[model samples]
Target: MTQPTPDHHGIIYRRAALDEGYTDKQLTRRVDDATMTRIWSGAYVLNTGETRTPEELHRLTAIAAVTSSPDSGFALSHQSAGVLHGLSLLTPQLDRVHLSTGYATGARLEKRRHLHSGALDDADTVVVDGIRVTSLERTVVDIACSVGFAQALAAFDSALRNGADAAVIAEYLEGHKRGVGQARRALGHADAGAENAGESWGRAQLICAGLPTPRLQHEFYDDAGVFIARTDYDWLGKLAAEFDGMAKYQRHLADGETAFDAMRREKEREDALRRLGVMVIRWVWEDLRRNRVVPMVREWLDRLGIAA
Candidate 1:
């Protein structure tokens, strides 16, 4: 069996394997037995478990692809960089790894990777998870140029939450007008207070649905001024929206608590909010998938008789 070095980022390169005294046949056996996953031709990541979602596999591919090539030759960009930076990508393209090269590669497409050729200045790159990747500002500009408005807003919102400076994003946009206008529109909708990709996605849906923008991470208090809960989104006294996901559900758990216990705690929180006569709406991943979020949320807005 091959053991990865401390420096390895959850994957082992064949060259590194050889240096560690493993033969090709031995490594091949490991792959055959499900102990290793061959990500690229000569790159492997441990396969102790299955990739639960397409997003997980995409992230693994992006990181493994970085080590598959000559380390100094590729800089992670776009959604790949987002993955490395721990930023939430709403709907990332999973088919290809995105890389930036210092030289003019021009075409920007490869079978398993998309190589974007540009002037890669040191100032525009940052090392993340031991790999070179585009800075948050550059990443925002890159995704804004390529994806739809909602997807772009999700990336921008996550970027801000992960410490991307708004002024810095603007500074990078100078002289880089290819998609600056579109990016500006997305930025206008971006909120740093969006706690995760789900909230960002919800915000994007509200924007596309032509619903009034809701305040993010708003706190509420009871009649005696005791705190109730800090909501994911607030239409200020009208409606509060929570993008309900597994992550949100898990948060309901106290340490060592069971699933039912978590649900009980969440029920309590919801009840407390309702006793204040506040309308609360919750959506899950399925809502986003079927495009039902818009009409469903719109219904809530109308039913509540809230102008927003």
Candidate 2:
């Protein structure tokens, strides 16, 4: 008998073949040849190679294998579902396998799988790569409803900018019999144009440190109406805040002829802002993470007479 082609999860057996004696010794031989990689006890892949991360490949395999289990009613949810449905921009950080199943099924996987039980309507779900997942709108709503507003806004912005359909998402929420109210409320507050994460973090730190919300991406003009410097975050009457991403600077410095030349150009940018009466307070990644941010930012704002 011809073997079934491996599913995305890498399972090679058909439903009817499970009763037949498929020895582990035979499977191990296939694995040795790199023809199949055993993901779980019973799951095997015929063609997936080592190019992809183990977690990613395992996630797909887990999703696929879950279907054959007694709890076949589960749908993919959260970030896993988002990734599968092409809604999430961030790659999976955890090896977590998220699945949603009916409460009646009472089926559960090991600790590696996170299971949610709910009555999901047809509109709230979509089939992705033969696995059911929460629809784009539902995924966004689920994230917004669970996370804080700022994070929700960031995720929502990324989703919209990456071509998530607002109407379709809204429709899915509307059609959701369960959690409709919560979803609608989150949708109302969803903003798809918040500043990037770095800018947002910098702004939050400044505010939390008693600095006023600076004008973001502000353009400065000379008395003659000529544009001078476009600052990342600027205060109207006195101060300016600049977030320097280390990676960005590293890339710029790498392209420069020498480290000193790159340093000179950076200093010049600061000097130009200073000449325009803008007292610049620069922050690097380390400052943001250390909680030393508030005191330093407060000191700078105080120097500019802009501290609250």
Candidate 3:
């Protein structure tokens, strides 16, 4: 194996490091020097950049898990499979990658890998990006089993948006009894209108709080037929919830405009919606992370008599 360049974004297994003539002491020295980052046990990152998301890093770790595995028969499954397949899901745990040996199994949790001993049918496995991964259907099923209903529903929604066939997923779900109830319930609730993880997280929080499912990607227009705005979530066409992420404002900049211009335009847009008799409620990432979004939105919905 060749040594990875400093800009390499892929996972580098321990064997690759050894083959590249990096001794154990040298590896530790590199880590101490901040030249290499160990994403998981025996898996080091040769590249360092700010653009990678948690999901992206977890996928690299999954690849590393595959490369470092002593067993030749293991396949990436569960959250690792979800990451590799590019299914949008929350990766709360980036320290480990989930793997399956595809045999009648034992559950093993190591420092860097979570192993599932359950055997997989040929139908559930597919090669993605030069590695074996659970099929989208199988991945969703595994996520539903592993991450609980709300989160799995979020991933399932993204998979569907990314072109996973809903019928096929349902068909695959037939024989899977584990977590079937939560899976089915989440299926009924999943919506592709969730454009990002924040929106999905917000929806899941509301659902968990026993709030009614809000309509997503709702568009509004003035009486004269002027398009006003599309909101993240809407209820009864009178109340709206917007995920006010900071990156969203950055997306507003054009060739000459500044961040201030973006903020001004956003406020004007909100004002226009207000003129159309719509009330917009906004929350940021902090609110979502602090678990205040559900309560805040619930307060609005309660006033509007919609969060039943």
Candidate 4:
């Protein structure tokens, strides 16, 4: 059995396969045998039986959507472009591949693609892995305009951290009139020090609830000037907040260290911070998702006599 080579984006176009001397019957047989999976019409990816992450699968589908589209005027946009740009999004809709054409053709949703029309200039687009996508700032602004405040805050934080020009994004926001107010608010609050969407969402909750803004990625040093730990959020040297996601432990795992080990290290760090007169509080992903962070933080703030 011969397997067809996919492109750089892991997409095997049927037209390219035909040009490579693969017959339709062979391709169909491979699909029947589950060796190849069709992501879009006339586009397939070799199914090696390895599980794909949601982002990875969505990116592949996005590539397939772009590959199968006859018109080249449209570029990957919105959440699709956000995926390509590596921006942290909150519960992004992966069911559709979002695209934007340069001209005003009006937005439409088809079988697998959501086509958006906007006035896109050359600077508004970039090529990622040979696929045309909206520029990072454009993608962030587009996302800010389309999604809610908290979700948009996450994207804006990520984009700023990724070196997207905040001024340009602000300029782009001025051009949009529909949801510019929310986008402006998010941009105003966006901080690059937020490491991920979880922290951004947490901060968003605090801000919307009229809580005092916390210093992000605040570092604590021991009495001897030794660096202790960096926290996700710090308020008035009285409280430090952490977003406790399992992925965080996994992401920061030291060499030869297990997740449990990472957690232990984190606990030790928290203890050190607490010894330095800082109250440490942590909330998990579920807490944030269920909107418990605000009240939890408020209680802590009230107990500590830190005015909200």
- State which candidate has the highest TM-score: 4
RMSD per candidate (Å) reads: 2.4, 6.6, 3.2, 1.6
Ranked by TM-score from best down, the candidates are 4, 1, 3, 2
Q: Which candidate, 1 or 3, would have the higher lDDT against the true structure?
A: 1
TM-score of each: 0.90, 0.60, 0.85, 0.94
Any runs in candidate 1 off by more than 4 Å, and if so which?
1-7, 50-60, 245-247
| Deviation of model 3 at 183, angstroms | 1.6
Compose the digit string of candidate 3's lDDT tens values, residues 1-308: 23444324466666676877778888777778776788767878864546667887788777766866677688898888887777777544556788888878688998778888776889879998888888888888778766766577788788777778788877767767778778877777777788876788889888888887889998898888888899989888878888974469778688898888888888898899888777888888788789998788778877877747
**Which candidate model has the greater lDDT, 3 or 4?**
4
Residue 53's lDDT in candidate 2: 61
Cα TM-score of candidate 4 = 0.94
lDDT of 1 by residue, 73-162 (tens): 779898888777777877787688988887765646879988877787888899887778998888877887788887888888888988
Native-to-model Cα distance after best TM-score fit, residue 204 in candidate 2, in Å: 4.6
Clashing pairs in 3: none
lDDT of 2 by residue, 135-237 (tens): 7767776665555444444456556755678887777666455555654554554444434555555554554454566666677776888776666666664
Worst 10 residues of 1 by lDDT: 1-10
